[model samples]
Every structure is written in structure tokens, then in C-alpha cells.
Target chain A: MSSRNRIESVAHQTVQKSGLKNLSFRTLGAEVGVKSSSVHYHFPEKSDLGGALIQRYRQSLATTLAEIDDASPNAYDAIKLFSKLFTQECSEGKICFAGMLAAEVEFLNESNREGLQAIFNMYHTWLLDQLNQAGDELKIDLPTPTVAHLLLASLEGALLIDRAHPTNDRLSSVNILIDSWFGKIN
Target chain B: MSSRNRIESVAHQTVQKSGLKNLSFRTLGAEVGVKSSSVHYHFPEKSDLGGALIQRYRQSLATTLAEIDDASPNAYDAIKLFSKLFTQECSEGKICFAGMLAAEVEFLNESNREGLQAIFNMYHTWLLDQLNQAGDELKIDLPTPTVAHLLLASLEGALLIDRAHPTNDRLSSVNILIDSWFGKIN
Candidate 1:
């Protein structure tokens, strides 16, 4: 990785492990084998680093969501793949960057705020479309917007709950939701 | 207020504003008009403060849930009161301390973990009971535990989303879930 990417990669891990509040440019510099000033040279302020981190995260999510949508044959398959993305993150014993930012939204600045909200807005629009398609394809009365919000919020909430008690995963939130809507995906 | 109570109160606000990672004895002391040592004297470690904060949170939740149950004639009313508690917190521009901790679960020690998990467990048990009663009272088919988790997770997730963009509240999460279940709570 290049020098700046190295700083961000380590910084991202730090945020996932703890939080954005615990992220320090100095610690990130040492982890990437550079002076704190050198790290600052890449990103002038802590907020700048935060902004770049979310910007990169948003780009990656946009790319992944597009790929998931393209690879799936139908909305059910598309939804399953989408739900897997979140549970996969939880299984890794970490919170997604979006979840992390949402948890600490108050401490975020305008750039960070817009970056993070845009991510949720990204999920909202994507899921809304997926559900609207499901409503037609499945021949069921699915409240597209409301159910879309439920899927998005429940999946996001499950990540936080999973991180707190990963071993206590008896029933998967996404499965419960999908089963209710589609009467089991299998 | 007693000195210890004062410390805990301010510490609660600090955690709600940011994450547990940002809570500092020095900052709490300055906010509470005491020396850092005084805050330390009250809670020796950061985890100790975290544990206490959750303990207080759990107690208040228990008390509130009981009150809501007693005041409401049926599960529908109880559910509305329950959802309002969370939305009210969001309207005040704050993330619940539980959301904050969940966001930074990787940084929590065993004591904090147990404290936080116990809070969720309490919700799980309480909501399960309410859903079962609702099933009987309303004569509706409901998967009690799964639906309960949906309610709990969606409400909790709504708080995080609400905090991220408080002014952008277009729809109320609780109402959406409730309307689907009980066909509007009003």
C-alpha cells in the first residue's frame, strides 16, 4: 500500500476495534511506521482523516452494492446477498464503519456527517428498489418503503447486538425478517 | 446531589454524547467541577465508570418498563410507551449509552460486556412477554420472539439513525412497526 493508504488502513482498524473517538493520528502514524507529523502531512486535521475514511468506505460500499445487485438473478437473491454482507461483518467480531459512525454521529463534523448519512441513504435507495421489485416479482403486498427501512435498520442493529454478544446468536435477524416477508428463502 | 451521584450523571451525558472511549476522568471532573482525582476516587477505572453508567441505565429502564406496563391497558399501549422512550432520547439529539457501547464493543471489558448484554437480555425477555400477550389479546398470529427482536432492534437502530440525522426524521420507525402489527397505535 502507499503511505497514505497505509495510514488509513491502520486507522480504519483502530476505529473498528474501538471507535472514531479513540482514533489518533499519532497512533496510526506509529502503526504505519511514520512520524505523527508525517501522518498530519497527509491529512491536515483529525476530521480530515475521518472524512477521508468515510469517503473511502462509501466508495467501497457503493461498489459492493452495485456488484451484489448485478450478480443476483432476482430481488430475493439480491436481498439474501445484501443481508450476508452485514452478518459477515458481524461474524468477523467487528462493527462496520457505517455502524461505527452512526454510533458516534454526534462527534462527527459536517463532512463526516454527510459521508456517513450518504451511506445509509445509499442503503435506503438500494433496498427500496430491491423491495419494490420484490413486491412485483413475488406477487405479494410488500410495503416497499417501510419494509425497506425495517430490513436496513434491523440488519444494522443486529450488527451492534452481534458484536456485544456474538456467541449468543440463536436466531439471525435477517433470516427472521426475510422468512416473514417471503415465507423462507430456501 | 451527592458527589458520587453527580459524577455518574455527568459521566452518563459524556457517554451519550460520544462513545465510552471518549469518557475521561479529567473531563468528567472538569464538567462536574471537581478534580480528576476526585472522579478517579469515585470510579477508579474507565471500565468502572462504564459499568456504573450501564447499571444506572438498566435500572431506569426496568423502572420505566414496569411503569409503562402498569399504566397501559394492553400490549398496544405498552408498546407505544416503550417506543416513545427511545424516540424521545433521539429527539434530544443523543444516542442511548447502550448504542454507544455497542458501537465500541471491541473496547469493552467483561464487566461492561455483561452490563450491556444484560440490558439487551432484559429487553428481549420483556418484549417477548408483551408480544405473547398481544398475540392472545389481538387474536393475531405472531412469532413472539422474532417479532420482539425486530421491535427491539428496530427501535434501538432508529435511535442511532435518528442521532445521525435528527432533523431528517421523515418517518417514525416505531409507528411503522406498530402500524404493521396493530394497524396504528393512536
Candidate 2:
């Protein structure tokens, strides 16, 4: 990878493991096997680095959603796939950057805030589509956008709870809690 | 107030505005009208200081919840009182410490993790009581524990969103959203 890409990649991990609030360009440079000055040569300030990091995170999320087989699978499979992808992302790191940023929305820059909202909207749209399909196939009264919002909020909260407590089984329990909600209502 | 209490009062604002990840004794001492060394006399290290702050937060929440009239004019009023107290706490510069810790769960110490879980359980129990009362009064089949969890999760998520977006309107909207949900099913 190029120097800029290398810096972004390292910065991504720093922000994920620590927090965007704690992100430091110097720390990121060390992680990438470069000096702070060298990293600054590409991105002049923390805000500049942060903006780029947020954009890259958004792009990655979009790409992940794009890879899902929304058309090929039944509603159950599609929704499961969707939740599974999000859970995997959380287990791999902390949370979707957008969701994490949304949790601290008061602190995000304008560009970052907008980016986070856009990512959530995309996820919501994908969820709505899958739910509609599921409703048709199974003849269920799937809840509306508000319910989708509730599920999204709960899933994020559950992950947050599990990581705080650090039980090995909690991640799977979170998935089961979400999956069962759909199944029971359907 | 004592020097320790003063430090906690200042640290609460700094953490609520800048985040726990950014809290520092030097900065807190400056805010509390004390020398950094004196602050150290009370809290020798960051962990000690953080534990004190967490304890103060727990006390505040307990006091606030106790002030709420569990045997209010009605079940709905009791719920309103509880939520109003939450919004009050957040606005007073000590936003939900548990919610903040939840965002950075991977980076916290064990004491902090346990502290967060304990606070959440306290809030959860209060919510369960309120929901149970509401169910009895309203004579509805709402899932008390589940609905309570969903409401608490939504409120926390909404606070983050409101902070990022910076709006009093969103806070009001959150209250309405919670009230409406219970009203609908119960």
C-alpha cells in the first residue's frame, strides 16, 4: 500500500480499539512504522486524518453491504446475513464506525456526522427490504421503520453490554436475541 | 466541599464534555481551583480518580432515582418522573457514565467495567418496576422486561445522537417516543 493508505489503515485500528476521541497522529505513525512527521506529511492535522478515516470507514461499510446476496436468499437468510455481517464487524473490532460515531454524535464533525447518518440509512434500507420480503414469504406483520430502529439500537446495545462484561457466549446470545425477535413475531 | 468531592465535580464536566478517555487530573485540578499536587494527594493515580468519579456518579443516580415518586399520581407519571430525572442528569454534565463506558468497553479496566454494569442494573431494576406497574394499571400484555430494555437502549442511543446533532428537540422527542410506546401497548 501507498504511504497515505498505510497511514489510514493504521489510524483505523487506533480509532477502533481506542476511540476517535483518543486518536493521535503520532501514535498512528508509530503503528505504521513511520515517524509522526512523516504521517503529518500526508495529513496535516488530526481533523484531516479523522475526516479521511471516517470516509474510508463509510466506504468499507458500503462495500460490505454490497456484497450481501439480498436477491438470492429468502428473507430469513437475508436478515440473518445482514445481522451476521454486523456482528462479525463488531467482533473483529469495536463497532461500525458510523454506529460508534452516532453514539457520540455530539462530538462528531459535520462531515463525520453526515457520513454516519448516511451509513445507518443504507443499513436501514437493506433491513427494510429484507423484512418486506420476509413478510411476503411468511405472511407476517413485520414491524415498521421504528421497529427496525429499535432492533438496530438493541443490537448495538447488546454488543456494548457483551464486550463490557466479556463473556465468550454473550456475542452469540446477542445474535440469538435479535434473530429470535424476528422469528417470534413472524 | 472536600478536595476529593471538588475534583469529582470538575472531572464530571470534563468527562461528560470531552469523554472519560480524555479525562486528566491536571485539567480537573485546574477546573476545581486546586493545585495538581493536591489533587494527587487525594487521588494518587488515574484509576483511583476514575473509581472515585464512578462512585460519585452512582451516588447521584441513586439519589435521583430515590427522589422519583414510585407511588406517584399514576404509573405514567412515575415513568415520566424517572425519564425526566435521566434527562436532568445528562444535562447537568454527568451524562450516563455507563453509556460512555459502553462505547469504549474494549479499553476499560475491570473495576470500570463492573461499575458500568452495576449502574445499568440499577437503572434496569427501576425500569422493570415502572413497567410492571404500568402493565397492571393499563391492563396490557406488553413484555415488561424486554420493553424496558428496549426503552433504556433507545434512550441511551438517542442521547448520543442528540449530542452529536446538538438539539434539545431530540431530547424532547425521546421522551415522547418512550411515552408513546408504553401508551400504545399498555
DockQ, model 1, C-alpha based: 0.51
Q: What is each candidate's DockQ, to 2 decimals?
A: 0.51, 0.32
> Worst lDDT window (10 residues) for model 1 chain A?
A165-174
For residue A170, model 2's alpha carbon misses the true position, in angstroms, by 8.2
Q: Model 2, A4-36: lDDT tens per residue?
A: 999988777666566676777677788888899
As a TM-score, model 2 comes out at 0.80
Per-candidate TM-score against the hidden true structure: 0.91, 0.80
Residue-level lDDT tens digits of model 1 in A1-186: 899999998888777767777777778888999999999999998899999898888888889999999999888889889888756754466666777777777778888998888888888899888877775555334367767777777776767776786643422755666765665533
Off by over 4 Å in 2: A69-77, A102-108, A124-143, A167-186, B73-80, B92-95, B129-145, B166-186
Scored against the true structure, residue B86 in model 2 reaches a CA lDDT of: 71
TM-score of chain B of 2: 0.87
lDDT of 2 by residue, B1-186 (tens): 887777788787676656666676677788888888988899887767777777888888887776675457666777777777676667733455677777776666789778877887777788778777665564334356765665566566556555554545345644655655555432
Per-residue alpha-carbon lDDT of model 1 for B1-186, expressed as tens digits? 998999998778777777778777887899889999998888888888888889999999899888988998889888878887766755466676777788877788988899999998888898888878885554324467777777777776767776675643423744666765775532
